[model samples]
Target: MSLAALINQLADEDTSALKTLSLVIDWVRPRPQETIASTLTRMEQLEAALTESLDVHLAVSSRLQSWLDNAQFFQLLSGLGLYSRRGFFKEISERLYERVNPAPADRNNVKDVLFLVFNRKGDDAWIHEVPDEALLKLLGTLWHFSPPALERTRIRVCTQILNAIEMLSIWVAAEELEPNILRLNPRVVDRESAFVALQRELAAFVQSYVRGLQDEDEIHLDHDHALVLIEQCRDEIARLQRRSVTAGSTMALTHLLERLSQTLTRIEHLLDILDPADKEKRTRRSIELFKTLVQASAERHGVRTLWRDNLRLMSRSVAENASDHGEHYIAGSRREYLAMLASGAGGGLIIAFMALIKIQILQLGLGKGVETLWVSLNYGLGFMLIHMLHCTVATKQPAMTAASIAEKVEQGEHGRANARKLAELLVRVGRTQFVAILGNVAVALTVAFAIGWCYTRLEGVPLISTNRYDYMLAGIHPWQSLALMYAAIAGVWLFVSGLVAGYFDNRAAYLDLAGRLRQHPLLRRLLPLTLREKFASYVDEHYGALISNFVFGVLLGVTGYIGYLSGLPIDIRHVAFSSADVGYAMSVFIPGVEAFAMFTGFALLIGGVNLVVSFTLALNVALRARGTRISSFPKLIRAWFQVVRENPLALLYPPADPRPEPLPDNHPHPEAAEAGQPPSDVTDSSPSTEGNR
Candidate 1:
């Protein structure tokens, strides 16, 4: 029952080493709320008990040595350290398969013993907490008590290490030959790559080591050249990773590079274990290798971790595209701020027309499904037209701007100056968003009211019936309706649309859609070369925005229908549309000033919810994708207050001062002028001019 009793029983009986080791591990394992010191103390007690007497030490040591002699260490030493032999997709599938249907255990295999010993979920959590010193001490105690492994066992381990190195080297070389990798470094294909040279060197080293072993000669194996090649391979992988950021990357390319990196690291660890020059160093390395094995074995069936690991790079790629699109939503100057207002007003005019169409569609006694389809078409086509005309939607700005803000946050150093810069950027974004919302609501309401007045004059009747007007009024009542909740739903759609835009942008780059379009056979036959090229260029620039706008419109239109089918209260209430509805309601019947104020107040509240929810979600995702955090929220808040205190109206409008002019292309850099030479770096600073060049 106790550890001392268990050791005594093992000494008396010829128990299997697996059962004995499992019992020992169970006794020494840390309990819940137990500290590492406690676990170390328990390990010390077990060591004392194991070395209590010569007879007991010999008996237990003999059993452990026997287990070592018979058990296959090759798979544990080689396979556990390396990834699955299968490709990335197959490896993922295999992990999932193993989770569902685990293979039968083999007592002869060390892997089975590992699985049995560290079988519980979250085993890696505590195992990782244990310091290297504690692990090394535990390993040292075990090695001291147990007799030395048989000479055959030692040779077999070395052979397995060599085999793993050879296998990993070949895999690395093959991965380097992948098309995505070659695209980044084409020279790798033309010559003997580091991976290939490593493979060749490994083969020679293995042959020499094997020959020396067979002849019983004191052989000195020089792994310097092989290690140098491994470093070179790693440098190439790093270079490819850096290049992928600019050239763009796909899941497959990311997975290949990840696998190559892991394989190369595993080879280095294996080589360390195989070093015979220093037993003490080898023992320490072996403990580290054992810890890696334990952690890997514990997480072997973790599907979520695998998915997260695989998606991290791709998510970053998507976020990068979103951030690029987001920069336009942030206005850095007065001209851009005014341009955003005009854009928002243009979008609002279309939205007012769209609202009238939605009302007409609902008035038709068409079936629910047909009505929903027509409404969706109106919203989708209207939004697409707005995008085509370079108009801005107020609600859509937050999702885009949040990503841009996150990019700035990621670029800033963690200090007071950086926080102040971010605060200034935030103020700019706030003013831009405020003007856009003001434009959208002001223009949509006016247009809708004018349209309603014209219809009433022409037909001698209000555009909306009294009952319908009352219903629209009640729908937007902040206290009496679910207007804010519905607005939040619309906010969620805005966030999703941002991601949709990013995904399409990433897909276009990955697939070279622009190039494909330019080369299309149909385009070649139907249009002139210049026209075809322009069309392709336009698509390349606006593909994501076009798709995302349509999708967002559909999402907004279909929410009420989904709620109707599901018998739920799900729906959306966008600020621009709500303002248009109120305008139509006002045209039918002029409510009291207090009632008008209430309608306007609720519309503004709805807009606030939409902005908050969308920006929060988008900022969270962007930060995670960039692997960064806002340096200090308190500092940022203080900086914001300081800016607001200096000028309360800064959040509504840009400064009166004009934007500073850029230096002419001929203007010399200060350093260059002092040196009396033309500046080599002088080039167009404008984005359009740079792109054209």
Candidate 2:
């Protein structure tokens, strides 16, 4: 296994190169670290020399292809060696690609190119659209591919076939596989065949072969504990044994194929069951090897189709469950409760307007406040608009259970636009309507202000006035003439808040109901139907955690709030004030109307706000969780492979983790016999019912 030897030997006769490499792989394809390193360095130098001479990737590639064509050698390389998957893939990627893409126009050559990766476990690594993708990249009518040469094609193809016996073994194993033998996947179909011919072929070969080997002692070694390992020497060994052969003066390809035919027969003869180790250990190693091959070989050499098929399975599984959102995602808004808030504010705005208008009409008749009313309306409208904006951008309060519903639902290519539209819709319907109502609720106060001012002016004294306003703070009362001002403000606050809260709750409920109608598939069958099953599976998957998290937070928040309130010992009370308290100094005040208006407004506002907050929070949580059906499925399955992939464990098993990868690109799929075909249908084990909303 000298560097100079690999280069010199691979440099000549494609057919001879394949045979030599096959021998190198079987007898000395560097498996140990020291051997592998030296081999890589030598290969690198060869590649450098070939590049300097001109373009020799194809020449060198055909030589490597010759090795893959053999069964024993292909299996040894694809299935063994290396802690790093990436490194292994890099080593053989270029050569594999060249083997597959030898010549764009040669049907035999093109088919040969495709065969190089048919059974390899590197799909998650390479080959976007199969078949034509390996031979030519299509863009509209234009196609891209490298030039082809017939140099050593005959000899190379022959040697490649002889060398590929091991690969073929794996290929056969991969092709006729029992669905049950795959990853702990529930989506696998039972022995049903999609292609009749293929199915028959597999049945005939696998069954007959298994039965035929029953009498052979060397058929398997550790049938109970390991994969059967076996060897099959090529027919070339026979010709070499005979000593009546021509080494160089004949059609090399024909001889190579002859060797391939005989070697596979020997492999069948020598079948031995391979040993299996630790349960987790075997799977871990298999997956790790698969991943390494995928990475290094993906870009350069098209990845194995089966690997891509698996990805297609996993990807479709994700897409199926993730299409919709949950009930908890919908949040009730204080803004949507417009009608109720207006019950309070609408009265106030009218009152304020009328009184000011009356004063202005009287002044114009006598001549005197046009500019003043204009400025006041401007200020009031400005404040109202500002408040609405603030609510739209404001962070959720403590009781809010929903987390980023707007963000999650609005993902994908046009995610931003959809989100923007939803936000805008919310603002117009939810916040704007409510604000308008609140504006009306406070209108009467303005009216009271104008009238009181007029009355004071008539008496040559200040009418309704206050030193300062700490609206939420209770301190000294308002001025003597304006005692009604306090009542008016209280009226507005109580009524507006109550209305807003109620509407928030109502809207949350409605939106949640409406969201369900948007499901990808409607449940129109019995309880145990697939859709329901999928739904239940996902819900049940995370039910424990979701419940636990909810319960824990509820208890914590309640305990904390109660404790804080208990710490306060200050007296809290509200004093009742009437028109009599002010006497005639607040002369314009009618006690009955003032009290009636204030109490009614206060009652409605308080109730509304409470209703809105509670409703909004609950619905918000539900809406956010509605679409995640995976929670209904088997939770352990989600994370099984994931756990196997981290650190030390990753060295041995497939990652049984549940981290969902990003979705595929948004490009349109081509119209093929099976366009956008999702692999095996798997039912999730999550519970369909949800408590998130």
lDDT for each candidate structure: 0.80, 0.33
The per-prediction tally of clashing pairs is 0, 110
Error of 1 at 661 (Å): 11
TM-score of each: 0.82, 0.22
- Stretch of 10 with least lDDT, candidate 1: 141-150
lDDT of 1 by residue, 442-496 (tens): 8998899889988998999999877788889888888799999999999999999
* RMSD, one per candidate, in order: 5.8, 26.9
Q: Pick the candidate with the highest TM-score.
A: 1
List the candidate 1 regions with Cα displacement exceeding 4 Å: 9-12, 33-37, 70-101, 145-159, 182-188, 191-249, 268-289, 307-317, 398-432, 453-460, 591-594, 620-693
Output the lDDT of residue 398, model 2.
Answer: 14
